[model samples]
Target: MTALSNRALNRALLGRQFLLARTDHTPLEAIGRLVALQAQEPNWPYVGLWSRIHGFTHSQLTTLLQDRKVVRSGLLRSTQHLAAADDFRRLRPLLQPVLDRTARSAYFARNSAGLDTASLVATGLELLAGAMTPRKELARRLAERHPGRDGRILAGEVELRAPLVHSPATGTWGSWGTRSAVSVTPAETWLGRPMAPVTAKDLIRRYLAAFGPAGTMDVQAWSGLTRPGSHR
Candidate 1:
């Protein structure tokens, strides 16, 4: 086996990620090829695209979001990410175990003690159905249902447990400092599609195509997903 030096590996990643040089790919094309963009900061996706796509503009991404061609949701590493609608449908289900595990964090466990989580998620979903509700408002409504519990914590749990996506306005350019007012909706409702069934092997291959020649641990680190030994 030929050994690849650190520089060689770095360049390989850059080439795969389009960091070596910007490309003329459309925003949707770039986003799809990358699989997902780290977007917890709200503005990072725009920035990420700006660095990789030639002539990329904030409106380009905003339009894609408004058109439901792309979606901003909690994905890889259980953090916010911007994924093309098609990719999101496939990726979310494959990465659901990670999201489920995140919902079991200490904060949710302690805050929701003795509460029926299934019922809670159902109520939250019901409240958000057919409408994009701001996080604070969602929290308030959930709090009203379970008075005395932390509304913020309850809302956070709903997001972690449900396949929800943040409204486009929240991720649009110039919306960074106003994330608190962002709205959440069910991913399926927003995208008008069902979550696609995908295997760990499929995810692994996709991840490598975008950020690959990587080891199993690298994939796990990037995706917050565990792989069977055979997949590795």
Candidate 2:
């Protein structure tokens, strides 16, 4: 094995993360190696990937999402991310606790009070099983079921309660096109695969590979995963 100094390790980390210079990898490959691409805003990942991968095109990523090779799902600090289906499946489950706790927060308490979280998740999945549903539509349905409530809150809760993926068009450049609304798909339907299993050890290893020689707190800060001791 090659010995590396701390600065060398940091530089390598930055290089792999696309901080050093852009490369020629396809979006799929870049995302696979990076584990997940930050996607809080629909177009952020596009810009992010563009900065790192040469000749990156919007169509390439949209096609990947449409074809089920890549998926936009909740992860990495309980935010939206673009990741390979394989990575999303494994990572989503690991963030379950974080999702659950977020659901318990004042947001859900104030907006989705008296809501049966499990049933809400089930209904959201049922609504999204056949096709991608706009966040507006999903929220409308939830509000309709509950009556006298804000759908946006319900929509946000659905995200916390279920593993949801933003649809291709939503992530497509200019898809918003003067619209303030958002749309999303369920992760399972989007990827055509069941959720992947994850363990703390496995998550830690992947985190280290992607953002390594770091403290456990850094991992916790990135992935909402908590572990004792700083070293892997």
Candidate lDDT (C-alpha), each = 0.87, 0.77
Per-residue accuracy of model 2 over 44-122 as CA lDDT, tens digit each: 8788888888888878888887887877667777777888889889878877777777778897789777778788778
Candidate 1 RMSD computed on C-alpha atoms after optimal superposition onto the true structure = 1.8
Per-residue lDDT of candidate 1, residues 89-185 (tens digit): 8888878778889889897888899999899999999988758889999999999999889999999999988889988888787887788787999
Off by over 4 Å in 1: 228-232
Clashing pairs in 2: none
TM-scores of the candidates in the order shown: 0.94, 0.86
Q: How many backbone clashes does candidate 2 have?
A: 0
Q: RMSDs, each prediction?
A: 1.8, 3.1
- Tell me how candidate 1 scores on lDDT: 0.87
* The candidate that achieves the highest TM-score relative to the unseen native structure: 1
* Model 2: residues with Cα > 4 Å off, grouped in runs: 1-6, 176-179, 228-232
